[model samples]
Structures are given as structure tokens and as C-alpha cells.
Target: MATFDARQMQSLTGLQATARTFLMVGFTVVETVALGLWLALVQGAPVISRPAAIGLGVLTVGLVVEHVLTDATVNGLSFSFPLARIVGISVSEALLWAVWLGIADRLGGVDGILVAGAVLSVLLVPQHSVEDNILRGEAPLSNVVNLNTIGFSLVEGIGATVWLLLVFEGQQFAGLLATLGFGGVDPAAVGLAALGIFLLVEHDIGVTLARQG
Candidate 1:
């Protein structure tokens, strides 16, 4: 809710941002593995059986909508162009929060967070295969999608860290790492491993991985 002139963030975080790329990728790999192991369990749980998959399907749609909404939320109609993304973002956020909370009650909130973190990890890091995908006409990530996801994740990480620093009392060492946790990661196999879990969870390994000799 704080107003940022934008310049300050760049100065405060460019180096960290560059470094986070690597971290994000690493985080993604860990998440992929965790999800694979957990998805089957979650599906079999009494509370989540069948219905949870339906819920996840809904959440996936929400993720796409969140993309559109975030833009409208951030850059509203200026004197020049009316960015209508805010409405979408506001709605998406509310829905995701509600869905996450509801599902978390049964599914372990950590899983929800993991899913979000994993998705962002994939979108955040710069992957080499994007070019191959674009050429193949499979699923080309547009510039807008990539840019907005990066901006959103970067700001969200910083904002949450600031809030934690203010509200929570903790050791300086713990705080430092927590503050830096939103750090990004590299866009290599590590990052792929992280995100690939989601694909695998949905039984779509072929989508995440391409045969390279």
C-alpha cells in the first residue's frame, strides 16, 4: 500500500534481483519434487478426493485471470491509455486468497504456497526453451506475461519481507534470509525441475521437458 516512485526499488534491488533469478530457479526444482510426491496423497485425502482436483482446475484458470487482472490493478487508465487490468487483478487476488484459504484448511496451506511459488519460479526465470517453444508454436510466453510476472513477484517478495520485518520480531540472521527468500533463480534445469513438477502432477511431463539429444 506504500507508494513507490519505482527508482528506489531499482536501486535497492537490482543486484539482489539479478541474484534471485538463480535462487528462484533452485526453489522451483525443490517444489516440483515435493508436489509430485504429495499430489497423489492429496488426491486420496477424504476431504480433497475428486473435489480437490476440480478445485485445482479452477485455481489454474484463476492463475491465468490473475495475469490479466494484475496489469489493470497496477497501471490503471492513465491520461493516455486506460489499463483495465486492475479489475482483473483485484478479482483474481480475492479469488485466489479465498480458494487458497479454503483449500489450505484441508490440503496444508504450504501446498498452495508451493504451487504459487512454483508457477512464479517458472515464469520468473529466463528459460532457454522459450525460444524453442515459440518456434514450435506450442506455448509461447508473451512478453507481457513474462514482464508482469517478474514485476509482480519482485514487488510481492519485497513487500512481504517489509511487512514481516515490521510486524514480526525475529533474529537478524533469520530475518536476513527470510527477507531474501523471494530472491530469483537461474532458468536452467534447476528451474525446470522446480516447475516441471506442476506439469508432472497434472501428468504432463512431455510439456515441461523436451528431448535434447
Candidate 2:
């Protein structure tokens, strides 16, 4: 039998964390591209290249895998401090959406990217809401449960809104708007639509959950 010393175990854990982070980043990219392709195809736009299309198809499988892993990893943590868990989960969700924004901007223009992200956000909001319900069930008195859910939700919403303004208001922010195909219709209108869709989906989930309970 082989055993690891304290330092060896620490090193192994570090490597595992690094690997998980990389996987999160990679899968987020895959999901973003897949979403953008889906939107483009639906719009009857022959936009994505053949190579990009093939890569995105293969990467689509990772979306579910990554989402499951993220939920499990956060719920599996053994944090003695209440704040640790809240912070961990909050940061994880924020970073996940941040990666989505970065990749979306690369895949399409700001408007298209916002639409794709809004779709992804709507798709995942129910999953997170379910997770929140499970957590409340397990620890009904835990304020951290509510805090984590609300905090992460706020972070995601604010992050997306800020990204929309940064990209659409002017190219001076990121300075890549032209290259990303962000110049057809009014980007401001697209941003507003994205924000409205996100809010509507989130509100719908909340109302459904409330009725269920």
C-alpha cells in the first residue's frame, strides 16, 4: 500500500483544486460557444466556421458534467466556519458567470453575447433554485443558506449588467466591440432585452417555488 505524507497530501489537494478550476474554465467556454452557435443557427445565420461548429458540438456534453460537478463540490465542502461556505459558493457562481461573459464576448458581438448569456442564465436559474431549496431543507435555520443563494444571485445579475454596459456603451472599455461583430442594430436595446429576459425567468422560478412550498 502507498501512503502520502502531510506535504504530499497537501500538494495532491492543490493539484486537484487546480485541475477543477481548469475544468470549470474549459467547460464554461464550451457552454458559451455551444450557446452562441445554437442562437446563430436559430437566427438562420451561417456564422460559425466549420471547425468551430465541430468543436462546439463535442464540447456540448461537458455542460451538464460541469454544472453537476460545481453543485457537488460546493455542497461537499466541510467548512467549519459558516462564512467559508457562503463565500466559497458565492465566489464559485460569480466566477462561473464571469467565464461565460468572457467567452460569449469572444464568440459573438456584445448583443449576441448578451442574448446567449441570458439564455444560459435562464436555463441554470432553476437548477440553482432547486439547490437552494435542498439546502434550506437540510438546515432550515441556517441563515448562510439564504445568504449564499441571494448573494450569488445578486452577483450574477450585477456582473452581467456591468458587462453589458461595458461592451455596448462604448468600445473604449474593452475596445473589441468592432472585432466581435457588435454593430448592427441598437446594442442598448439588445442589452435591455437580455436584462428583461433574465429577470423574468428568475421571477418565474421564484413564483413557482413559492407555490410549491
Candidate 3:
């Protein structure tokens, strides 16, 4: 009989980590875009909602800021560039959040947004767990319920909630806009500002944790 040694186990772990990363990146891109398209069809929009488009643009800027601040790089990339990580992660995150917001809007307006935020927070647990495990080269299910996961869930929930609130209630600022001789604040603009702040904070925390690990 033959058995694996420590070196062999380590090598296997590395291979698993690389495979998981590639799969996750690919799946995220596909799923996010698919979801956006589905939401567009449901909402009768040409492609995506105005708020979603604004959110994506703001998210891109936020990701660029995060990359500049952390100088973080995703591991196991065959080809690396100054903006590769930013572009990949930004597209995934932005599209996911855009479609998520669209769904929340349809669920029940303001109430639905809150519900969706909570749901997304819960879902992020497993997603973050997988990413964390990959970084440490640990087994897929190892230490899934951890402090970092919980913290990220909380952050995501709060961010999503605030973003949706601002977007939905953008009309609340109409009086202020009137004073400025403007028609009103567009919901898209409000969403952009709200999501930009949230993404910046969330990405900073995520990068810090990865660096610590």
C-alpha cells in the first residue's frame, strides 16, 4: 500500500486552491450577467435599470480605489496586469449587486430591499468562506463558520440596506434640489453615491483580512 506524504498533501492543496479560484471567478462572471439579463427582462427595461447602471459605474471606481490602496492581487492568475484584478472583481461585484438591487425593488419596494439585503448577507457567508479557504489552502468546508465570515455578512447587509434606501428614497431630497433650482436628484445618482461608499469600505475590509491571512 502507498500513502501520501506531507509534501504531496501540500501540493494537492495548492492545486485545489488554484482550481477553486478559477472556477469561482468564472462562475461569478457568468451568474452575475445572467442574473442582470433576467432582471432586465422581468422589469421590461432595455437591458438594465438606470440605478443598476449607475451602481456598476460607481462600483468600478470603488474597485479601482481599493486596488490602488491595497495593491492586492488574486493568486493563481496565469497572466497578471495592473488592472486585471480590478477589472475582474469589479465586473463581478457590480453586476451581482446591480441585479440584486433590481430583484429587491421588485420584491416589495422598500420592504423588499431590506429582505433582499438580509438574504444577500446570509449568502455571502459561504461565498466568503470559500474565498478564505482558498487563500489558506484549506479544505473547502474547513472553518466555514468564522468571525470573518460573520463580519463580512454584517457589512454586506448594512451596505445593501443603506444603498437601497438611498436609491428608493432619492425623492426625499427633492426639496433640497428645488432650492438649488434643479428638477430633482435622480435615484441613479443617489444609488451611485451610496454604493460607492459601501464598496470602498467593504473592499478595504476584505483586502485587510486577506493580507492578515
Candidate 4:
């Protein structure tokens, strides 16, 4: 058998790593474009669907941002948001507290209580405020739509992952184990999603600009 030196092994591993990066990035961009083309083709005739398309586009953007930027970038964003996020934090925090209290009994006593708390902690608070801050358009609900779509997409993705995991061999796959094993991340998808979102937003903005022109 031909033997690889340490440098050769490193070179081979680097090649594989570079290949995965290219593939992942390509996948994200392709998926984003595919979805946009799909939506445009299917709903091109309907005026009502334009908003939906934009909302979907924004969701894609959030996915890209979160995916590419990672937890680190988002957390770092906190420092710059003091002025913009104050109302979101205050109002959302209060609303979160209210919902937590109102649903306490419905949430059941011990186990259910924790579940209800989890909903508030995990799902309820951050997004509405986030949308509220970004909603600067004449279309008042655009931000809300963007926020909810993002939340929904993420939920869908994670749910899909879990459902797959529940099946027999998902967790056993060599690739899956290798990726998860190394704590490797999918920054390509993140970049792709971000690029898609930007394209979508630009499209929307372009349409409006052309109309004005």
C-alpha cells in the first residue's frame, strides 16, 4: 500500500475541506435562487403574492445572516443596538412576562410550567422586537412578516433535522458523524442565504425604484 506522509495527509485533508466549503456555499446560493425563481414563476401573476415573496426573501436573509454570522456575530450586534432596541426590549420583555403569567396554569404545574417557560424564553421575545426595529417601510407589516418567516424557516429546518434523526440511520451516517464530530459549521449556507436575502431585497427595492423612474 502506498503510504502518505504527515504533510501528504494534511494536504489531502485540506483538499477535502476546501471541496466541502465550495460545495456548501454553492448549495446555499443555488437553493436561494431556485426558490426565488420558483416563487416568481408560480406566483408572478398575482399582485397579492408579491408581499409573500418579499417576506420569504427576508426570511432567507435572516437565515443567511444567522447562519453565516453565527452566534458570535449576533451577540456582538447587541453593542450597537442600544438606541434601536430599547423599545423592543422593554415592550417585548413586558409582553413576554405577561404571556408567561397568563399561560402558567394552562402550561400545567411542574413539567408543563417548564415547557411554557421554555416557549417564552426560546421563541416569544426577541423576534417581534427585532422586526419592529427594522420595519422602516410604508408597508407597516413587512418587518413583522420578515421576522416571523425567519422564525418559521429556522423551526422548519430544525424540525426536519430532528425528524430525520428520529429515523434509523440518520445519526449513523458517516458524513453526518464527521461534520458533527468535528463541530464543523455550515458557513457556506449562511453566505448563500445572506446573498439570497440581499438579492431578494434588492429586487424589491429595484422594482419600486423602476416604478418611480
Candidate 5:
């Protein structure tokens, strides 16, 4: 077996890296367009015609395909840098949020943007804390999904699900929250959920970080 120098290894992986970058770009575009179209229809925009809706559906399918392909490719290729892997995930998540906000903008505008931002900010806190530890070498990257990661995933998933439901079907769920007397979008609910999640996982890294100082 031949040994690869740093330059040689980079050259060999260059094509795969380029393909991954292009895939991410294509996925972002498709997600943005599909989400925008779906939200438009949900909001009764009258902007999406029949053919446009069909095209959006196709693009959404492509998004799913891209997600699977991205995971497969990344895991299949032996990447050298842990930081690179983390950064790639971070960029992908940022792109996802960008597309989400694009859809929210179509659905509601500035209010939608603010609500989405707040929701994402709160939801990502615990996960970010764990990730911060991992990136800083305080936590082992090989043990990425420990109790903290698992807890973060659960909280994030639950909070995000609630937020999405409110954004897409707030009117329907208004009856459920009738006792709260807030009939429309409730940013407060999402904020509270996020806060609870943050507190739940705070011990994982927050206490540790505090004690270190």
C-alpha cells in the first residue's frame, strides 16, 4: 500500500469534497424553493400554480435524496479533520435555517422571521453547548452521542416540532391552547419550551464550564 502525503491526500479527496459542496448548494436551493412554495400555498398566496406545486413536490423529493446522499457520502469517505466534519454540519444546519426562514418570510414576513429566529435560537442552545465542548476538546468526539447529546436531540426535536406545528397550522391548534386565550401564533410557547430544554441540559456543560473558570 502506498502512503499519501498531505498534498496527495488533499488532491485525492478534492473531487469528493467538491461534489459534497455542490450537493449542499443544490440541496439548499431546492429546500428554499420547495419550502417557499409550500408555505405560499399554506398561506393561500395564490402564487403557486398546479405545475409549480408538482415541481415543488419533485424538488422536495430531491431534498430527501440529497440528505441521504450527503450522509452516505460523508460516512463513506474517511475525513481527516474532526473540525471539518463539525463545520460541515454547522454549515448545513445554517443553510437549513436559511431555507426555513425563507419559507417563514413567504408565510408571514418580518413577524415570521422574528419568530423563527427566536425558536431556532432557543432550540439550538443545549446542542450548541455540547458541540462547543466537543469542538474545544473538552469532550471526546468519538463519544459524540452521550447522555448530553441524546438529551439535546430529544429536546431539540420536540421543540422544533412544536414550533413547526405552530407556524404551519397555528389556526388549527388555537383550540387546544384556548385556555391560554392566545388564538394566533404564540412565540411564548416556543420560548418556554426552549428555556425548559436549555435548563434540562445546562448541567451537561454549563456547570462544567462555570466550574472551570
Candidate 6:
């Protein structure tokens, strides 16, 4: 019987590491493009609405600023094509948001979006479980799964979802912005801006916790 060694898994090197890195890159590119095409060409969806487009733009710019301020980079292989990696990641993030929003819009407008948000939130737990462990140099399945990690991710996701809906749908929030002299802006765009701030804060918190652990 062959015993599994966690250290060996973490120490992937040379060809194995390179191959895995390229595989991940290919997967990201394929997934991003496929989702965009499916939403636009196959489903005949608008790809993204004006409000969503504006919101996503804000979110992307916000992320870039956050990265700059925090001196953080997207985690992945970028040894050779750093610029391409950054551009690809930015494009991928935007496309993912558009795809999810497009699907939710078709499902039932606001209700659909909420449903989709919930699903995505749940899906992220396992993903974070694996990614976080790997990034921390532990076996992907180490720790028997951390409840704290799950809790943080869930809160982040739910908070983001609620924040998004409130921005786009909450008249009170818009009214407040209006009172602040920015009433002319589209509510969705405003909501997205707030969403970006929320994400920045959430990311910082997550990073802090990860480091502490």
C-alpha cells in the first residue's frame, strides 16, 4: 500500500509544478471565455446591463487600487507573463460577474440574482478550503476543514450579495446618496461602488485572519 505524504504534495517541483501551473492558467482562460460566449451567443443574453457594466467597471478599478495600496498580487503562476496574468484575471473577474448576473436576470430578476448569489456563496466554501490550504503550504485537505474559514467566506459572500441588492434596490440608500449631492447617479452604479468598498474591506479582513492562523 502506498502511503500518502502531505509534504510531497506541497513540494511539487520542476516539470510537475510547471505543468500544474499551466493547467490552472488554461483552465481559467477557458472558463472565462466559455462563460462569456455562452451567455452572449448561446443564451442571447445581453452579456451585461448598463448598470452592471458600470458596477463591474467600478469593482475592477477598485480591485486594482486595492492591490496597489496593499502591495498584493493575484495568487498564481506569473513568473513569465505577469502582465498577461493580471489582465486575464481582471477580464475573468468581470466576465464572471456578468455571467452570474445574466443568469440571475433570466431566472427572475431580483429574486434570481439573490438565488444565484446564494449558490455562488456556497460554492466558494469548498474552493476556498482547497485554495487557502494550498496557498498556506498545507495539504489541500489538511485541518479536516476549518469552520472559521467557512464562516468568514459565508459572511463575506452573503454580505456582498445583500449589499449589492440594497444598492440597486434600496431607495433609502439612494436617498442618502442624493442628500449627499450625488443623487443624479444611477442607483446600480452607486450600489456597485459601495460593493467595491465592501469587497476591499472583506478581503483585508480575510487576509488578516489567514495570516493570524
Candidate with the greatest TM-score versus the true structure: 3
Better of 2 and 5 by TM-score: 2
Q: Write the per-residue lDDT of candidate 6 for residues 1-213, one digit (tens) a residue.
A: 134565556566455546544443443333333333333332333445564555556545543333322222224343332333344344545555555565566685567768867766665565445445544546656753566566655664665465556544566567777887768987655554555444544554555554454
**Candidate 5 minimal-lDDT segment of 10 residues:** 202-211
Kindly list the per-residue Cα lDDT of model 1 for residues 146-209, writing each as its tens digit: 3323443443323222322222222333545446562242222223343344332321122223
Q: lDDT (0-100) at residue 97 of candidate 3?
A: 62
Provide the global lDDT of candidate 3 against the true structure.
0.55
User: Model 4 Cα displacement at 78 (Å)?
Assistant: 44
Whole-model Cα lDDT of every candidate shown, in order = 0.35, 0.46, 0.55, 0.39, 0.47, 0.50
Q: Candidate 5 on 162-182: residue-level lDDT in tens?
A: 555665556656776675656
lDDT of 2 by residue, 1-213 (tens): 145587788898898667655544544444444434433332332335664445334334444444443433334333332443434344444345435555565566656556645654553454455445543344423332333245345534544554466444444443354465665535544444444444434433443343343
**Residue 79 C-alpha lDDT in model 5:** 38
| Model 3: per-residue Cα lDDT over 1-213, one tens digit each | 135687788899898656644444443333333333433334434335674565456555554443333332344344333455445545655555655665686786677888888877876676566455544445646766656866866676676676556556657656765676555556545554454455445554664566564
Candidate 5 accuracy as lDDT: 0.47
Instruction: Name the regions of candidate 5 deviating beyond 4 angstroms.
Output: 1-8, 45-63, 77-112, 124-213
What TM-scores do the predictions have? 0.25, 0.39, 0.51, 0.25, 0.35, 0.49
- Please report the TM-score between candidate 5 and the true structure: 0.35
Best by lDDT: 3
* Candidates by lDDT, descending order: 3, 6, 5, 2, 4, 1
On residues 57-176, what C-alpha lDDT tens digit does candidate 4 reach at each position? 443543443223221222222334333233433344334433443354454444444454456545432443243333222232334433333443344233322322222123334465
Per-prediction CA RMSD (Å): 16.0, 13.0, 12.0, 19.4, 14.6, 12.5
After TM-score superposition, the amount by which residue 58's alpha carbon in candidate 5 deviates from its true location, in angstroms, is 7.0
